[model samples]
Target: MFRALGAVLAAGLILAAAQVPATADTRAPARFSEFSVTPTSLDVDHPTATYTGRLVFTGADGTDQGVPGARVCLDKDGRCVATTETDADGRFSSPVTLSSTGAQPQLRDGEAEAFFNGDAERQSTFVGSGIALHVTQVQARITMGFDHTPSVVGDPVEVSGLLERQTPDGGWIGVVGQTVRVFVDGTRIAEGTTAADGTYRISTRVPVSDEGFWGVETPLPGRGYPYTVAFANTWQRAAHRTLVTGFNAAPEPVRKGAKLTATGRVMRVTADGSTEPATDYPVLQFSADGKKWTDLYEDHPNSQGYFSLSTPAERDGYWRVRTEDWPDLPSTSSVDYVDVGYRTAISGFNASPEPIAKGRRLTVAGTLKRDTTAWKAFSGQSVKIYFAAKGATSWTYEGTAKTSSTGHFSHTFTAAKDGTWRAIYAGSTTYVTVTGPGDYVDVR
Candidate 1:
């Protein structure tokens, strides 16, 4: 027994010496480095944003180094989720999905830790300073629309909307006492605060800008809330509305050959609540029907923002002024009107019996028309025939004829000598005057 005990003691000393090399080889310290967290601002209601981080090792020489195969863990409210190994650069990042398994379903502060297997000294025992990780709560909802569509430039356009929040019971309720801003063509034109029930309205006389789309924005304060520089988010990022109106050409029944003017104005609210001109020299337009507007090349606005374009009113049509569509503002059309009268056109005329003897009768005929029904015949129209001898410098009135229902007119006169004959239709208040080409009747 004594001999066996002496051999066992000698074997234990040899085994202890063999383990020394393995223990010292694992002495590298696991330390956290520059760990960071994002989503400094997250909505309490949605809370869908992820939290991500990094880690490095502390060498024996007290220097930062990336340690591979070391475990790192994330903690929220003191309980922890398991860590993954430090990667190529000693960096590890993952989202903090929840507080912890079996913990409360609530917002909580979070931290990070690094651990080395089989070493208690290198594992994290307390939260470190200068590290950020959190779950935040700040939420909002917004809705907007225009009260009056197709409004005039000087008319009050009412922009209204609601600011709401979700209740614990999953129902949405209004947010009261919050300020909301309204814009036209990217310019702030009005503002209002939410009422007790969460509704907001602003009836401001705005200038005509672009065609129609307006903007509405509302920012919520993060004080005493979850959002800071990191949690910077809001519901106003998507508020866009529209202000609509129509264009017109005033005063119908514009007589033929008279000048008709085109006109419109745009009024905009300044930042200080004063009104000013919204657009310059909007394009003048005309259309036979109200549906399609054509650009009128002749007229534009004067220096004082007054628009007038004189165009011959020869055909019946509609007229108005319009602006181009912009990203922030809707294209606009002003209310105006145009009713053109007729333009007279002599279709044709001729003298029959090209060669006639003296004392023989000659016949002259012609047709008259207006543009109302596109070259429709003009009945009961008076057509005057004129005669001019071969050497006569001016024509003399010969005879008159009334047009039939088909726009035909005729007259017979004695052919006393070689002469040229012509037909003319004196225009009325609605139709323009016209004359047909002369026809020669040679009398021998």
Candidate 2:
């Protein structure tokens, strides 16, 4: 245990000891020794982004030793963000890497202090600023594109890129007449000097057998990044892959909830009008009016590059096969039209007691059935009756008939002049409308 003041009182101070210098004290005194940072500069952009410094104190014998444990902060304010302990060399290192992204390029100031293990009193050593650091957001970037991706490997491809600077107003301006290098697999293959508009075009060959990434890099000097990336190889332009998609579906006029078999074939286009089977494939996709395309099912293609998917004819829509784009292959799509139709049937339309006298009652009967599923009877449908004089271009509305439970409809008409009679139904969203040629009725 450290000697306490109790020991000083045990040996009572006498008037004779007062004759000694006023500064004389039995206990040792602690004072600031040394405080400094190495390198005197920091780069906030580096990954190892941290600063190191040390703090020490002088003993009563004038020998400097590193403080074992001390409180440290990054500002003049006495708040300790961290605590540091000294090593055998009396040196303490606290990392100063925690900085905000917006911190500007400026000197950082700090202070350090120590506390007695069991005492409230404290000693402080201030750290004046000397280190300079830069904190900023990188503003230079590049944009580039290819004329056609998935081209034949080992063949020539047109590659282009542009060097640009992000302005203060959030706009971009081209960095004109700059030397840019093109790299493939980290090897410099070609170089292009920027034009007046900061754009550069280079014709290069495929670097790899299957595929290889190509990028644009700039060698800007000084405070900025020494090797900065302007563009990354996103599209494999030197590709030698092609995907041919084709699709077909039946029955031509399928009904809702009916089994629909969609057929498709995937081929690799080696040349114009030439193709080979594509073994690696996925299922088909379908879409309806006002709806997005969705996968038909998780069905892979057969070894012959042929795929068939059976899905319920749920709605009116179109089906297509989608070929995904990958490392060396370009994508493609082929569509097949599908119409879900309603099988509507009109029957039993006849007038009883033909040749009836005018103003006499005549009964007309019929039935309206729609093939929802194998010709189900549609009941409660409103049917309009129309009549036209014999040899007339158009018919005139006569009356209305409401269908019964069996889809049977009947209307009693008082025979008027000679004319024709028929029933017409307006279509609904799911069913097709039905119209019929009138049953000729003669008036005596």
Candidate 1 lDDT, 15-49, residue by residue in tens: 99987865354444455655555554334444433
> Model 2 scores what on Cα lDDT?
0.62
Per-residue CA lDDT of model 2 for 1-444, tens digit only, reads: 336676666555654477576763433333434454443343324312233455555656876665555444443124443455556554555554433111111222323233222112334545544333332334668877776663565556677878776655778777665667777767777777777777889777656533356677665532423223356566454443556455677875676788888777666644333566766455567888525888767466787778887888877788766666453364545667776767566788877669889999998889988886477667998999988887789989988898898989989989987878888887566776678656888998
TM-score of 2: 0.35
Error of 2 at 408 (Å): 1.8
On lDDT, the leading prediction is 2
Q: Per-residue lDDT for 221 in model 1?
A: 39
Error of 1 at 433 (Å): 1.2
Clashing pairs in 2: 151-239
